[model samples]
Structures are given as C-alpha cells and as structure tokens.
Target: MADNENFNSRRHVMRVAAGVGGAALAAGLGVLNAHAADSDGGRARRHGVRTYVLVHGTHSAGAFWTAIGRELALRGHRVVAVDQPLHGTERFVPAAYQTQDLRALATEPSPVAALTLDDFERRVTGVVRRAARLGGPVVLVGHSMGGVSLSRVGNAVPELLAHICYMAAFCPSRSMPSLNACAASPEGQHAITPLDQLVGDPEKLGVLRLNWRTSDRRDRAVFKEMICAGYSDVAFLRVLEGMQTDESMTAYDGRAVGRADTWGRIPRTYLRFGKDRTVATELQDRMIAEADALTPDNRFTVHSVPDAGHLGPEDPARVTEMLHGLRV
Candidate 1:
C-alpha cells in the first residue's frame, strides 16, 4: 500500500507538529530547547529546503511523527513521515486486544506474523526513491526500530540520500549486524528489554506481540520507565493508547548492516537521549562507536539531550533546529 508515498499531506503535518501550543511547550523546557520562536533555519536550510523522509519505529504509525513533522513542515521543508509495513493505516489492530481478552490475544493468528524486515525495506525504499525524484537532497530520519529499515534502505540506494539520522535508535554494522546483536552487547546491559511485556513466544508466533493495554500495573510501569520515564500517569496513558500490539520479530533479527561503500558513504547524525533506558545511552554510544569504526572518515555528527528520554516530546524546538540546520 505504501507505493512511492510523499508528503502530499505536509500542510496537515505542519499543523499537528506545531502541537501542544506555545503555552505547553514553554511549561518546563530549559534554556536550549525553550519554546521561544527560534526561526533561523540553519546552514543548508538558509540556502534551500531539503526533503525529509521520516521512518517511525514499531508499535506506532505515521501519526507518531505528526508533531515533529509538523515543525519541519512549518520550516518549509518537505516531510514524508512514512508508515512502515503493517503499520499506520495498514495496521492490523487485533480484535482480542480491544475486548480485553488476554487469552485470545496470546494466540490471535497474527496477520503480521508472516511479515519480515523485507516488507519494511520495501515500504521505506519506495518512499526514499520517490523523494529522490522530487529533487534536492533527501534526509532520512529513523527512531528506535525504524533504524533497521534506515540502514537497509541506505544500502539499497545510498546515492539518493544526502544524510541519515538516528535518534536514540539502532545503527547496526558488522560489529552489530542486527538489533538483537546490539542488545546482546555489554553496553546494552542497561537497557529495559520488552521481554516482560510480551504476550506470546516470538518463536511460536513469528512476531513479538505486546499487550500495551494490559491491565497489569507492573507491566505498565515497566513500559513507562523504559519509554517516557519522567511523564505523569495521565501523560503515560496518552502514550499507551497509541501503541500497536504486534511487531515483526524478523525485523529485529534481520541483518541490516550497511555496506561500507554504500551506507558508509553517506553522512550521519546520532542524537543521543541521555535518559533513554529503552535503548540505553551507553548502548547508543556503543552503536556510534561501532559505526565510526566502520567509516572512520565519515563519523556521526553527534548531539545529546541530557534530559530527554527515548521520545523527546519535550525536545522543544531543538530537534527542529538541528534538523533544519543540518548540511551534507
């Protein structure tokens, strides 16, 4: 269904990404990420607009980037926040989940079971290729599991991309061929694995299914601690309501290591989140280190949000500033 999608709905994204209003965004944000209108589009942006291909992680849809995309769109950049395979409008929200039927949920014949990382690759690659045709440089942004698709697509069509960015996301290479490998590393020790929240065995179901709506307080707590660490109960509930119940296991197991000549040629940025326990900060550092080792000359242009977690909804305007300011 994601046949060469583009940001035809960018106007809509701009409105939403401008979200929370100037009031809420100004509430607790610190000096650097304050909500004050920081309108100077940096470097490449001061010259001309660039195309941004946004890839969301598992359990969420294109709506996941609505707020962020909205900000980029307002800055006059083209934002294509893609819905990865079996995600977004294409998501198969299981019936068992809605009815609170935990028993049925465990074995609900997941339509996403047969799905592999190949499906993800096909969707993102098509979007990136189409964006390339629209002219100007294409900047690809990936978060969490979305990074897997980013690496695969980068390998498939390296020349089309001017840059790739990972925000508290995985960046697999020879040293880390897949996300599981990244988790198995020593630095990954600090991460909060989703194992406790799983509904069924991955081998049995061929997918890593979650019950994000589980009534269990402990499970909810684990998810909150891992994802939006400092959020209040009401805030975390809003986050939970948007989560999907299943994700392809093969997507995580897939060999997404970028080719040295292809993916390695493109410049990259790793926006590390200091408070991200889901994909621990140390683990993020490990990924950047491994990637730099793979391509010594073209290391990541690193940045950090010491106060931000995995989902920096509080990133204020910093994310928009960095994205708008980026150059090849």
Candidate 2:
C-alpha cells in the first residue's frame, strides 16, 4: 500500500509538470532538486537567464547585430536588436541605398529629418520593455553612436536593466555633451572621418546624407580605414549596402547624460575597442572617465577587446564570450 501511494503521487506530479511550459517545468524540477539537495543544508543554485537588447550605431540598423544576436541565441540567451528611428531602413531615402546609386536623395519631405535623441530613446526603451517581458531585465548593449540612445534608455528605465554595456560606445555626462566630448578627445580629431565627406547639405535638406555608393576609390578607402580596417572590399561594400543614406542631425545635437540618481544606480560596463579608428581609443577612454566622474560612487566596470573595431557584428566569437560572462 505504501509503494502504490508513492507511485500515484509521482505520476500526478508528472501530469502537472507536463501541463506547464517547458521552461516552467524545468524551473519547477530545478527547485525540487534544489530542495532535495538542501535537505543536507546545501544552497540553491541561481536558475534565471538574462536577455540582451542591442542598440545599433550611426547610419546602421538592428540588422547590424545579426551575427552577434545569432551567437547569443545559440548559447541559450534571449536577444533583441533595436532599430533606431531614421536609421537603416527606417530612414527616408527616395531610392534604395543597396543599389549603390550616389544620385539617390530624399526628395520628398520626410519626418526622419526631425527625429531627435528623445525619439531614439523612446524606441529603444520600448524594445527593452518587451525584452523584460520575456524573462528578466536585460543587459543593454550599444555600439558607437547607438551608445547615446542606450544611455538615454538606461537613464529613463534603469529598473528594467540588469547591466548596461557599451562597446566602443559613447557614454556622455552632464559636463561633456556628445559633440563636445568628441571634440575634446585627441583621438576624436585623429581617428574620425571628416564631416565634410557627407554628400548632401544638412542646412538645405535638414538631414545629413551620405553617398554610400560613391564610386570614388579614395573615398571608399578612407571610409573603410575609418570604420572597418580589417574588412575585405566585398565585406566593406556589404556593410555600406546595409547603411542608411539620411540621418537626423538632431540625433547628434545633444548629449545623453543619464541621471545620477537613476542611471547611476544601475550596474555598467564599458568595452573599449583598442584599435577603433572611428571613435578612437583615446576618445573612448575620455567618455568612460567622464561617465565615471558623473557617478563616482558607482564607477563602470571596464574591459578591453584588444584590436577590436567599432563594428560588433564582425567579430562574433569574442563578443559572444564577453556577453556570456556578464553577471547581474
């Protein structure tokens, strides 16, 4: 009679477990196993998984995170790459940029020109919220100019984040605005491509447009050197193909200095790209230092990806390893 009762109880537990989702079932089993182990006074193991929200940089879209996102997903992690307003396919271009047609322009009046940093923040924040619904708070990651949006989101919703990570990204402070921060750093002047290279007049069009299809070999060479030095010609062209032609100047006008009370409370990490030419190592360090100063009591935990460039998707293995190691 005792053996029959135990078998009936075990069968009932299995039926209940089968009704819940696989993750819930696994969690339930983990808890039961943990309780069994703790009968001997052992501690329970942490069981929750972290989600990541990746924000892209200037002239790029969420597709920029394709490689890295895939790798993270393969490692049993949740990933969401955000597409900033007026960037990538979201931009208002008359013709498709993939055609490599330099003549393409934004003839029609479009709202993309009016997009601001706040708009970007809102979009990213929405994505972060959705990611939070999936499991737990996210590890927000941003690259290059996208860091500005990430900072704004962190400031706006620090509670929804587990950790904020900047990869060769700009993390501005109250004292140092975005444009000013770039100008103040020695690497900013040395490593960046000149603004004069832009194709269209910002005053006339209200947007900064680049001719990614420019047939000028010199221009292509300079662009490659500035953004992706190690990429092959075909790979560089593919990157350009994925880029948007028009970008809102308003997005770059101000700094995204997060609030000390809110953003400061959240844990932060900075991954410096040692060989980054676009946002040089010196400039990256300056921004990191300024961010540290802003929240002196809760300074960022800094790391380095030696010889890494500004593009995160190019090197999946190293980025995946770094992200996998993050603990919240």
Best by TM-score: 1
User: How many clashes does the backbone of model 2 have?
Assistant: 0
Cα deviation in Å at residue 101, candidate 2?
A: 6.7
Query: Poorest 10 consecutive residues of model 2 by lDDT?
Result: 23-32
Query: What value of lDDT does candidate 1 attain over all alpha carbons?
Result: 0.72
Model 1 ranges off by over 4 Å = 1-47, 313-315
C-alpha lDDT score of every prediction, in listed order: 0.72, 0.65
Residue range with the least summed lDDT across 10 consecutive positions in model 1: 17-26
How high a TM-score does candidate 1 get?
Answer: 0.84
Query: Which portions of model 2 miss their true places by more than 4 Å?
Result: 1-46, 96-110, 179-187
**Deviation in angstroms for 131 in model 2?**
1.8
What clash count goes with each model? 1, 0
Tens digit per residue, CA lDDT, model 2, 1-328: 9968655544332222110000000000000010122232212223345677887777677777777777777776667777777654454565535564544453434476788888888989998886666554478998777778778888888998889998887777675565435544454654644343455445456555566667878777766766777867777777776766566666666568888888888888888877777667887788888888888998888889777666643657888788778878
Question: What's the distance in Å from true for residue 207, model 2?
Answer: 1.7
